[model samples]
Target: MSNQHAKPPITTTNAGAPASSDEYSLTVGPGGPNLLQDTYLNEKLAHFVRERIPDRVYHVKGGGAFGYFEVTADVSQWTKAAFLNNVGKRTPLFLRFSIVAADEGAPDTDRDVRGVAIKFYTEEGNYDIVGNNTPIFFVRDPMKFPDFIHSQLRLPDTGMRSNNMQWDFWSLTPESAHQVTYLMGDRGTPRTWRHMNGYASSTYMWVNAAGERFWVKYHFKAEQGVQNFNDAEAKAMFVEDLDYHRRDLWNAIARKDYPAWRLEMQIMPFEDAANYRFNPFDLTKVWPHKDYPLIPIGRMVLDRNPDNFFAQVTQVAFEVSNFVPGIGPSPDRMVLGRLFAYGDSARYRNGPNYAQLPINRPINEVHNYNRDGPMRFHHSGNQPVYAPNSYGGPRADPQRYGDPSWFVEAAEIMRTANVAHKDDNDFIQPGTLYREVMSPTDRDHLVSNIVGHMSQGVESFIQERAVKSYWSPVDADLGARVAKGLGLTITA
Candidate 1:
């Protein structure tokens, strides 16, 4: 065994001056009001006042830790990504778990999608895998994302969340049935951040050295094992500790009981995607594991908690567009939307120099003509900012890294509805899931849970719409059972 833990000596300000004292703030007249003339006091107070930055619009409540990703199995045949090119390769990483659609003060145990963002500091660059716990999402198209979020958020008039508005959007968007079923189930309420599984629901592209592209989906199976709270249990946990999930994660790491997850990937050949039964790139669907078996790629263990929560967790940005040379995005519409939205939101919240932050900065050397933004920290070293200049500066190197090229067949370009497949009838998968995937006890609990939440809304029509959507997906009997539990009759 090796002892890799050694603390660095404490230093003073940016000028590298040694500090005599750090404990007491400089004050006037022995506990009188602090003097404005004190440089250290002014620096500390001014920074403290502005320490808090803007909160993220989504995934506001988050927890993070330092970790390493160790490759367990070879995946070089599928992807030319250097991080996963060989077995036994370990890359430093940071993991952030967050609650989607919640305020910073919101309870961690709320019934919301959990975000799992992994920043892999690779030799190529920082590669980020941003995903949720569920394998599917509510909307397939990116254009509908804003509308969907608006519907799920607080009502414009009342400034309160409305179940009616949520159901109204879900009922109208039939494509949301698959993800909605998973969200309504017990898995929606994870016990803690450590116990939940993370998934890359969107299909991505992995190109090998030979220039062969493969569609890939990522899964992080929790080594702690999946554990969820029932509706009652989740509510109780919230009241007891609003930061239950965050606390659990912090305590686990503090005790040296590091939590881990196995990285698994489902890969499909490029040609198969075009002729596949379902649209492989759809966000609202899942690739059957039977057809595309999960291949073990790596393992990630979170070992160290952040020393400064705000610096490491709150300001840390993960963007889908932050891809290295080999790993790239697929044509998944939702992913295409996110590649733009995530980076744009980070720029808005943290400024254009968000990438310069320590937590988000890449371990590899960065050279580009990107100069002069808000809070520009780096000096380009007298090198000409413009390319093809007389002075030596970073020049475009195509041989070192070639651009990604994937085959795209002829298709009409228009803002029409999604192309429906022969198997595109929305209800079949959710129906099978309800009948086959769930056990008898699980089915009973599912019905009970649905009825409990549905009973709270005031609008009768909205309730009817909700019931109909559920019934249409599963059997009529299951729907009737929920209706009976809610003291309502189902009509033909």
Candidate 2:
């Protein structure tokens, strides 16, 4: 409604000066040549040349819209986060959905994990929850992240994605079994961003007002319920519309059919990590619901679409380290590494002033001393820019907003497993999923899909490794079915 009657003024340059004509670029004597003397023409050309910043390293193709997150339940017992302090309190938010392994022009129907990057503009500051649609990740260690992504991307020489390469990396890395099984199953190709749930696969620590700490994971359950396309249906939709998810989201919001999701949290006491059967900080595994149950907290509704795709959606940044007073990072290795990596990558791709951008900026008045980067918008007035001054300047107050404290045991500096981890192996959870969770139809689909994807294009050697090493470890039935489907012999 704000833009309902906005034909008030003509377009202008970045400077407030009104433009004389947008139809024609200034030229010397009617199309002789572009005139360098024409400031507007030169400015336009220069800005156009540098319109785009570097795309994201993983979540390159993304789209999002403006929305609000409203607390619907009391959660003060587990978290002291102000955003979740009161029921019926509304916080402005933006949720950007993207594919993990995709080019700018890649189809929406590709079988890839979708990013669910959310930013909450609370009174405290900007808090970001960077996650994927799946509950777990391909690998737990950040050391393997770059190499894993390289395998998913195009070959160095031909610049074409090789199935062999992807399977090879995943096969050798046994920890990827749970997430790999989920990805190769029906859940991989979601019908739309609206249909799939978003999960914080990494562990986080939240402290209450009473100073009690709890390890937590976030789950945003889609109100529309889970929906997915079969491999054939996904391929057909890709051929029909490359921008299927993008158009679906925009049109749905425009038609007043706003999409919504319920926010849920799984909380575990700080001391419970010591007794858990598996590594509580492992990125490739999920906390079982039977142990840590989901508590309904809030609801998120996307009610409006971004007016400019490049401005709002493309330029937006999400950092794993973006936390408020109560929420903080955990001992998760992947999470620890991303705390620095995401912010650094965002700065390199979007410039040092990316946080100052409209979509990424916090609603709270930024009171830090950080100033004078390229395209710096606001310069603090009269106040002393540096600390240790006689003049009034914001000083650090550890009691008011300092990060929460957690006990850490001293260990030797070396590559090691999770603390108190029981039998550090990968396939147990995936085997549980195959045996106890999925139904007969789901199991059939999983086997057929793996065989179809692997045998169709992957090299014989790669396929053999994938079947015997990855699939078999997860479940013998799954491996045998895949081998039979692929017309390959299964041996002891």
Candidate 3:
């Protein structure tokens, strides 16, 4: 009115074209039924019906936050990762704590492994540590992953989870014994997401500038302190409040009580791995601290909660394949499988343009020829979409960096069992853990806990197999006690 052109009233429409009317649909007459030719009405109804997307196959229930990872100690000598190049260098990060093997609406307090995934928005790219609370996994090979997950999930016919199915899979796969021991112990059910630790179960490779490589594992020790609930307590919590873990995490952050974890690593010399006591690369096993001690690396603190749960938490994707220059994958079969599975799952769930989402997008500028897909928010703009075009499209930068190489003299690529090491036997560490690591009270609770859950399954053979496995690892007396508690005869 005052020399400025008056703006028109806003009108909603499909795509971008303005619509004159949205409340009423085009009809045969003014007061009659709507017609199919009503493009606006049809578009509105169509979109509203298909708004929801496919849910995640696992780690469905989760809590997330925004935070920073600061390099508190000197770890640059291990690798040339820019995030750990300097002390006090803070990198923006988003962390999601989840329960593995649960549905989207499953109870948060269920007795299952917790997933502690961190996405570090580094200058180079978004590096993800898609890991779990246990340092060891059920299977060392990827071919067994689907079967393992199927056992944990609901039965195909009855739509109910079966303890028989779970124990049968565990008993058959001897590699699962280490993780099964931990699962049957107190640590299986964490008290809360804030009080749990995380581990990169798969061994990774860290390469230095001198082309020297070392096998490493990442451990996140909870600064809030590790706490866990027994089987009964976890069940009661589920009935009382299914969202107890989620609420606890949200309330803690709301009260300005942030959570933190001290990042540590178990480093093994390259040559030492070749002659190690056990397979350093086995996902089903852990490297003893005596052989490879924990070295302090950095600190990760979750200071802020996500503003929107759906945008930041639900849509967040973590892939094991997201590695930086100095960080690379090892020959661990489980890890190699996940590198493909995680990324493939995201693409199927969120389309090929999933990486363009704000939560998944890296802090660094993405320069690629990949163009045109569903939900492609960003356009290359004036930049050419195809490579080798004389129009000055972005080209591959070879000088940037490359992964470290090692001499491999092995012949044939056929799958085979690991060459047994001096301490390759399964029962030794689990035995040591039960006898030495646990106190008298802890052992009593561990036995009681196993008996409680094992009673749910009707298969006596499965129970016997479980008891034998537990006993073989710890002590015959402990096994006998568990058998007696389960109302079964303990065979000497």
- Model 2 lDDT on a 0 to 1 scale: 0.88
> What ranges in model 2 sit over 4 Å off?
1-11, 16-20, 25-31
- Residues 328-430, model 3: lDDT tens digits: 9987878878888899898998899999999999989998899888999888899987878898888876666776556778889887877568877767767
lDDT of 2 at 74: 86
Candidate 1 per-residue C-alpha lDDT over 1-492 given as tens digits, one digit per residue, 9 for 90 to 100 = 235697656657546766555787667778798767667656666778987777776788889999999999978888888988889999999999998877888889888889999999999899999999998888889889999888777888888887778878887888887777777788879998899999988999898888888999999999999999988899898789999999999999999999999999999998897778878888888888899999888999999999989889988999999898888988888888898899989898889999999999999888898888899898778878887888888787788677766767799888855555656656777777788897886778778877777777747787776677656556676788877887776575
Best by lDDT: 2
Rank the candidate models, highest lDDT first. 2, 3, 1
Kindly list the per-residue Cα lDDT of model 2 for residues 130-210, writing each as its tens digit. Answer: 999998998888989999999999999999988888888988899998998888888999999999999988999998888
TM-score of model 3 (CA atoms): 0.92
> Which scores better on lDDT, 1 or 2?
2
Clashing pairs in 2: none
Predicted structure with the largest TM-score when compared to the true one: 2
lDDT of each: 0.84, 0.88, 0.85
Q: Residue 164 error for model 2, in Å?
A: 1.0
Quote each prediction's TM-score.
0.91, 0.95, 0.92
Which parts of model 1 are misplaced by more than 4 Å? 1-49
The regions of model 3 sitting more than 4 angstroms off are 1-41, 381-391, 490-492
The TM-score between candidate 1 and the true structure equals 0.91
